[model samples]
Target: MRIAFASGKGGTGKTTVAVNLAVSAVRVGLGTAYVDCDVEEPNGHIYLEPEKDLSLPVAVEVPEIDESLCTVCGECGRICEFNAIAVLGDRVMVFPELCHGCGGCFLVCPVDAMKRSGRLVGRVETGVSKIAPCGEDRTAPGGEGEISFVQGILKVKEAMPLPVIREVKKHIPDRDIVIIDCPPGNSCPMVESVRGADRVILVTEPTPFGLNDLEIALKTVREMDIPVDIIMNRCDPDAELPAGAFDDGGARVIARIPESREIAEINSRGGLASLESPEFARIIDKILEKILRAAREARR
Candidate 1:
């Protein structure tokens, strides 16, 4: 099943949930792949360390203007909704960044002065992790097996993230459980990453800002008609948002990871909390159980 771990804002622990879920899934002998859809800041590889096996460049089409096509009537410029085409007296210029590949400028050009051209957006890298010893399957909750990991990384400074995210998702295995580490914020990139997945796990904290963004993300996912569950990371009893809020809103509360100094230390050291804390690992296993159960029900 394809599951996407996303959040409305940054530092809400989406990647933390995604990586731990992937590691847990792998522990059960489930051939799994983790796609880091956060192309702008892909840190999923930092934990999994998948070997770079394949790299593919992703490109997007933009408008290119032909200067020799006679008069700059401004027709093409006016027709472009993205403001990609501009008329400068007798010359017409096309801004590649502004172009959305809608081809409106090309269609409106009387002399066919506008043409489609490609620009490199980003690249996708595929890598597999070396098999690690089975140290009592911490992800399955009373289960045991060896774990294998795989990850995808997008090239840095890539503005268009959807293309790279789509390419990374293409590597998901049929029988394996797939977890996508989606980019933060409820934008096009986040939408593309979670689209058509079996389920989505929204990770957030217990603060007002977290609740506000969580509401935005909930709306986005509801509009997409996808099922979502909540995981309150760094949960505190005295927090502003209650744990039952998600359940009351018609979504399940899969897990609640309490705030801990040990977790902070492990996070500072760039390590997975589940790897450092066995208690947190159990919580991840419970989350995985919910995911697995949901996947099974969908298939039936």
Candidate 2:
């Protein structure tokens, strides 16, 4: 089963839920593989320090001008949909960052001077986490004992995330449950990560901002025709739309993690919050059960 955890906005604890859920799934011997689709800022590896067995360089095709071809009719620049190419007098400059690799510029180049060049976009690292030498469980929250797998990381300042996200998702095992830690946003990256997912767990807090973004994310998921479940992280009884509200909406309230200093302390220490907090772990387990139930029903 491929499940993706995403939020409409950042800092809403999507990663926290995703990482924990993967660990929980692995704990039950599901052979879960967690893919950090948040390529822009992949923090999942920080929690589960998997060894780097294979590192494949990811590149994107960008327009490269061959100045020797001469005729700078400026047609390439004019035809570029992304404005990635610019022609100044007799000089043609290619701004790779602006290029979307559509190949339109090269196709439109009258002189056939524009060609495709590979520019480094990011890389995918595959490996498994070796049990710590001390015999302690090193896997993050959801990883109860120890598990190993592959992880992808997008180079900083890389604007394109969908390609890398797709590449990483391709590595997911057929029988293994895959949990994608999506980038925090309702943009292309998040969309790509959530696409074709069996279920999406939208994690959020109880604040007004969290509620607002959650609604937006819910709308997005509905539009995509993807089943969604809500998990209210840091839920406070005093906050609006208490636990029952989420359940009332058709989407189950699988987990309600109360706000606590322990969460902060563990996060500060770069440790999995669910691993240190039994309450948090239980909440994650409930979400996992709901996910499995939904999966089984769909199969039937």
Candidate 3:
């Protein structure tokens, strides 16, 4: 079963929930793998702290024009939808960054002047993290089990992150459960991260900005025909939602992590909030039960 934790915007404790859920799943004797798909700024490693075992570079194909074989034809430029190539009278320019690596320019070149070249976009790393059971120190020996970890690190200043996110997901182990820590937003990165998830949990605060983005993310996810559940992080009883925010959508609030300074402090110190907080652990356990139940039903 693949469960993805995502948020419409940053700082809603998306990664916090994802990491703890993976650990909690492992504590219950489930083989779990945590994949961080937020390639642009992946920080789940800070919590998992896995000892990496494999590192692979991810590259994308970009057009490399061979001037010697070039007729300076404008066919390549016209075929590129992203304007990655241009013909300037006597010269041809190829902008690798602008290219989507679709190889359209190569197919359109009449003289075969376009050569394929690779640009290093990012890298995928895989490792294992030993996580202790709930209420136990993770650093101590005799931990319950190990959680496989896979994450992507996109090269700085890279415009395209989908390729890196795809690479990270390719490393997902064949575990009983997989938890994806998605990028914060309703953009392509977040969508790509949760594309194949069996269930999606959107974490949001009670603020207006949080709810606003949540509605957008919820609608988008629903359009993709994926099952969605919302986790109200830092819940405030007095907080009010925007009108019709959750009315017709099948998405519902499945859990709420109430406002607590202790939760914040634990997470701030790079500790698993669920490991030390019994209340938090119980919440996670409930969510895990729901996920497992859904997965079993799907299997049936």
Candidate 4:
């Protein structure tokens, strides 16, 4: 099963939930993998800290102008939806950054003046935790664990991130479970990360901003026909359960992380919640149970 964790806004603790769930799953002896498909700002690595095993550039096909054979007919410019290509009387300009790598300019060139070239968008990196050191857990020393990790990192100031996100997802195979740390917001990048997911865990807080954004994210995920669950992070005992809108979505609340100084301190230092807070194990266990149940349903 492939599960994605997403949110409508940033700083909703989406990565925090994804990393912990993946860690908990690995501890349970499942063949699990974690894919940080949030190419724009992948932070799951700050927690997993897996050793690098593979790295590759994720490039897209952009139009390459052949000035010698060019007619400067505006056809290439007309066909480009992203305004990436422009043709003047004697000059052809190509904006690689603006290009979505659709290759429309190459196909629409009447004089065959447009060719294809690779434009580096981002990169995909894979790493191994405990699985690489030991073939099986029993043979390894005590306290050693296993988990696979992958992440997509977009180039600075690059507009197109879908290709990188797709490349990262290609690492995921049919497995017991794969946790995806998706980009926040209801944008194309977030959609790309959430696509093809069996289940999506929406992480949010009790604040008005959190609730409002959660609703927006739900609309997009619901359109994809993917099962969704909610995790109310930073839930304070003194505060009321501000999940009425979430309740209306009809998705189960798998977990609620109470606000505490220990969790805050650990989180500030980029620590894994599942590993740092022993008191939160009960909540993590319940969340893992729901995640496995969703996977089983997907199998059926």
Candidate 5:
């Protein structure tokens, strides 16, 4: 099962929920992997601390123009919908950033002036890391069994996170389970992260901002034809979950975590949030149970 933990916006404890759930899965001896798809600001490494096993650069192919070729034909420019290649006067300028690496310009060029070259964007790192002990499983070995971890670190000032995100996901093993820590928001990055998951866990708070964005997030997931459930973070006692939050979205709340200062303090100290709070641990267990059940049903 590829479970993706995502949210409507940032700072709703998305990573906190993802890392904890993945750790819990590892404790149960499930062959698990965690992919931090939040390329722009991947933070799961801060928790998993996986030993670096391999690192590789990820790039996209863009058209490289050979000025020596005779014809400055406008064919390449017309075929490129991205406008990556522009023919002006007698010069053909290729914009690497705007290129989608489709290599259309190269294919359209009759004189073979256009060629494909790698435009380095980001790097993908894969490693192995053990989940920290949660105390619930006293017999569970610590640092004895490790789960695979992979993350994509977007190059600074790069705009294309989707390519890097796709490369990182390619590392997901064909196995029992994998948790994806997705980037926040209902935008393209979030969409790319949660695109093909067995289930998407939408983490949100109870505040008005949280509720509003939750609706948007649900819509995004629903459009992708994926089933999603909520993991309410900082479940405020005074604030009620919006009644119509899931109105037509087909999403429901699967777990709720009330505000806890202890969790906050532990997180601040770089400690695991879910393991430290058994209350939260129970909630995550429920989440895991739900995911496990869904996977079983899918197999049948």
Candidate 6:
């Protein structure tokens, strides 16, 4: 089963929930893998601390124009919606950063001057990590077991992240459970990360800003027909949420992590909250149970 943890915006405890759930899954003796799809800012490795085992470069196809054989007919420029290829005077300029590799330029080239080429955008790193139960030492041998780790690092100034996200997902090990930590927001990168998830957990806070973006995320996931639930991070019981917060197409609030300074401090120190806080551990277990139940229901 593949479970994706995402947020409407950054700093919503999305990665916190994802990594802890993966570790909890491993602690329960399930074959598990943690895939960090936030290529532009992947930080799950900081918590997992997996020993690096492999690194592979990820590249994307871009148009390479051969000016020598070219007739500046402007066909390639006209066909390109992203303006990746343009004819300026007698020369053809190709901006690989803007290219989506849709083959529009190649198909519309009347002189066959456009050729396919690769642009290195990022890399995928795979590693192995071990996790123990909530109370046990992670480095101990008795109950600890290995979990596969995969993350993508996008090169600076890269305009696109879907290519690197796809590359990272391709390395998801066969496991009883896989948790994907997706980039924040409801953009193309977020959509691609949650594409085939059995269940998606949208983490948000009970605030005006958080709920506003959460609505957008809910719509995106519903449009894709994926089963989704909401997790309220730093939830305050006294704060009254807006009326109709759960009305219409909104997802149910399946779990809530209360506001805790300890959790914040632990996370700031690159420690898993579930391993340090008993209350946080219980919340993770409850969330994991709900996720497992949802996955089973989906398969049925």
What overall lDDT goes with each candidate model?
A: 0.75, 0.76, 0.87, 0.80, 0.83, 0.86
Q: Count the backbone clashes (under 3 Å) in each candidate.
A: 1, 4, 0, 0, 0, 0
Per-residue accuracy of model 5 over 24-104 as CA lDDT, tens digit each:
777766777889999999988888888988999999988888889939879999998887878898889989999877777
Q: Model 3: per-residue lDDT, tens digit, 121-161? A: 99999999975443333332333488899999999999899
Ranking by lDDT: 3, 6, 5, 4, 2, 1
Model 6, stretches more than 4 Å misplaced?
131-144, 237-241
* lDDT (C-alpha) at residue 293 in model 1: 87
Q: How many collisions between residues are there in candidate 5? A: 0
Worst 10 residues of 1 by lDDT: 141-150
Give the per-residue lDDT of model 2 (tens digit) for 91-195: 989899987777787777778887779988888877765332212443344433444565667788888877678888777666458887888888788888899
Return the lDDT, model 3, position 144.
Answer: 49
lDDT tens readout by residue for model 6, 1-300: 888988877888899999999877877667889999999999999998999999999988898988888899899899889988878888999988899878888888888999899999999999987644433443323334677899999999997999999988889998888999999989999999999998889999987778898888888888988888988989875544466745764577788788999999999999988878988988998998888887777678
Off by over 4 Å in 5: 133-144, 237-240
**TM-score result, candidate 3:** 0.93
The candidate scoring highest on TM-score is 3
Cα lDDT of candidate 4 equals 0.80
Best by lDDT: 3
Candidate 3 global lDDT: 0.87
lDDT comparing candidate 2 with the true structure = 0.76
Q: If both were scored by lDDT, which would come out higher, candidate 2 or candidate 3?
A: 3
Ranking by TM-score: 3, 6, 5, 4, 1, 2
Q: Candidates 2 and 6: which is better by TM-score?
A: 6
Q: What TM-score does each of the candidates earn?
A: 0.86, 0.85, 0.93, 0.90, 0.91, 0.92
